[model samples]
Target: MSAWFAGLLLAAVSVLVGCRIADTDAVTPVPQLLAFLPWLLVPTGTGLLLALLGRWWVGVVWGVVVLAGLAWFIEPYGKDSEPSGPAVASFRVLTSNTQFGRATGALLAAVRQQRPDVVFVQECDNRRCDIALRRELAVAYPYRQSVDGAGSQGSVILSRFPLEPAPGVPAAMGMPGAVADVHGHAVRLQLAHPMPPVPGGLGPWRRELERLRDFAAAGRGTPTIIAGDFNASQDHAAFRRILDTGLYDAARLAGHDRAPSWPSRTTPVFGVQIDHVLLTGDFSVTRARFLTLTGSDHRALVTDVTLHRR
Candidate 1:
């Protein structure tokens, strides 16, 4: 095959990879592929390989397209100048799906080690499997809340500090979470599990994202921080809209977005990041990273942040 033909294929695939992320009404029917955008790097690297095959100019063209994509779509976050301030308080927060039923002792061990001030669990709705964790968690987190939805993995939040469920406030996130009273500052914390943006499921996914955005607008009685399996990444336009509303992804802030969190690192190269810890402008992320979990397709997300009174 001609080197030009190979280069052409690379450029064509590059464009296809770049156009997968969308968050709008116009493309509601499109399959969500942003989660795999990082794989585009494969082609970016291929461009370099093309030059070795003697298609130097074609390689240059392919390289330009892929690099521009990296800048335009996957730019490294946390490169922005950080806000200077004396942190009112710093705390550790952890969010994990806990898979379905594998609530092994390793989970408890990690929690004990991390000593997260706030913990959010998704898919623990199977009372027999996940809800049972209440006893183990209570040892470390005296304040706890969990909602075993009718089915699936219900959500739960365990905190070392006082946590109160907001009355008359509706989050419509389809799971349970709580408002944390941190040293007199009320921080509305919610565990979000939006519907996966799969074919025939995009509508509900989009709606859930919009609801979270609306909830943010309805005047949270206190600052809010949402952490859970978002099911969608910043590559999704819908997720980006949520972040634009003064909320920040701690992983992005700590330069961890490039790291994938799902599909298990057993095949690390193919995994994509779908889980996140989102906080409002009320806090500045101090540290963020993923934690290894036992028997989970997802890698647990852990973050530390300093609260800001605005």
Candidate 2:
């Protein structure tokens, strides 16, 4: 019986290690696996504590390792810091994860009222990607690029300033998408929606992260802004990998780290902030907050940023 228990414990530890390795940029689908790690570890840790305590040092060591792993794997916020960079006039950015096409009217109203210089909309289908939305948005934004269609699972960017398409960055497992350089600033904008790992769902989220990191790294000379639903939260290791690549999260920088965005209608006891806007280089965030729900499952995120001309 002792031997059997020992074998079980070793298997549990091995599985934990495998999970950690998979969650890295290497395996690409590990982020999805991370959601289950907490529940998995609880039983294993209890067994280890009860059985190994006779060997007190062994139990202590195991406890430390497990706790450390949890801390490293789960991160809920980007690094905390006050806004840097010289103060430039604030420019508003509206980022919304529209549930395909349900809240077009509400979105149009927000756009008309706020008139943000840049707008990022996710989960937009081609049916709603018509001239009316464009016409209404055109009052404030003159340039736009959208990938809306029956098979569309990405986003669009509308800017008041001219936008030139930058090179397409290869995604981890899907076709590459476009990134654009907004003229008149030292910043470039990348809009993406990486595939979520839902069991047999899109199998590789890491590939998306790696692709985005590679694209951001190539443009390190200029400040870059990446906005999207991302699907994964800041607490996951996948998000940490992106942060490790020197990008700053604009929402956290603006003091909105606890802003929960998912499930707009029903507020959970503990909310999740899955929508995000991350930045790199010299741009500073002035404000980042969730907008009122407009009949979508996810709330909108708006950020005001200031970029210095150096």
Candidate 3:
């Protein structure tokens, strides 16, 4: 019995260590094993709880171990802070995963109401091209780049400012990466939609993450903004890789830690902020919040950011 208990404790420790390692690299596959660890230890944790009232030191130790293991599995919370600069002077950006050509009117209305200086739309479909929506947005956003086609499960960035598209920045399969220079601000935007682990495309998803890292690194000196449906949660390896690049997550930086933007129309259970906007360089986020659901699986992420003049 003692030997069996020791084996269980060892297993818990191993799972914690594996999760930590996975957090360090975006290329690493999501640790599905770690996700199941808590379920496996529930019985042990309950036993420890019962034993604690009876003054069992063994139970106390097991409780500590279980708590520690659970803590390791959770993502560390960011310290909350107020926006640094003038919120009114900041440039507003809205990013939404459109679920590929659904609810054109609602999508257009959301964009028009927000009037963000820059808008990033994901899951763009070729068949249901909303020409009227495009025309309406064109009035405000003169600069746009969209690859709406059958093969191109890509994204589009419509900007109020002059947008000069960088070469090789077109959307691609899996994680569609794009970069655009917004009014001389070299904002590197990546519309990543990484494949989920269960679909046997984890390798391709990791490769896409590697590609995004290389792209972001290539534009090291400029102000970079990467946003989209990363598919990977905050706890996943792919999301951590972008964070490791020394860029600030706009939402976290603005003090909205519990904000989850995915599955927009659904409840919080389906929402976990798979959509994100990350910034690097001399800029401060004024405010960040998830917008109302626009009939899609993911909520729109709107951020007000001020770029400090050099």
Question: Which candidate gets the maximum TM-score versus the true structure?
Answer: 1
Per-residue lDDT over 40-118 for candidate 1, one digit per residue giving the tens place of the 0 to 100 score: 6666666556655675775766677666766676765323325454567789999887666464455677788888899
lDDT ranking of the models: 1, 2, 3
Q: Quote the lDDT for 72 in model 1.
A: 72
Model 1 steric clash pairs: 123-153, 125-154
Give each prediction's root-mean-square deviation over alpha carbons.
3.6, 4.8, 4.5
lDDT of 2 by residue, 262-297 (tens): 767654334567778887746678787787656688
Error of 1 at 80 (Å): 4.8
By the lDDT metric, which is better: model 1 or model 2? Answer: 1
Q: Which ten residues in a row have the lowest lDDT in candidate 3?
A: 26-35
Model 2 Cα RMSD, Å? 4.8
- RMSD (CA, Å), candidate 3 to true, equals 4.5
Residue 67 Cα positional deviation in candidate 2, in Å, after optimal superposition: 6.5
Mind giving the per-residue lDDT tens digits that candidate 3 earns over 61-140? 76677667666555443333333443323588888777765745567887778788887777666665336447677788
For candidate 1, report its TM-score: 0.83
- Weakest ten-residue segment in model 1 by summed lDDT: 21-30
TM-score of each: 0.83, 0.74, 0.78
Clashes of each: 2, 3, 1
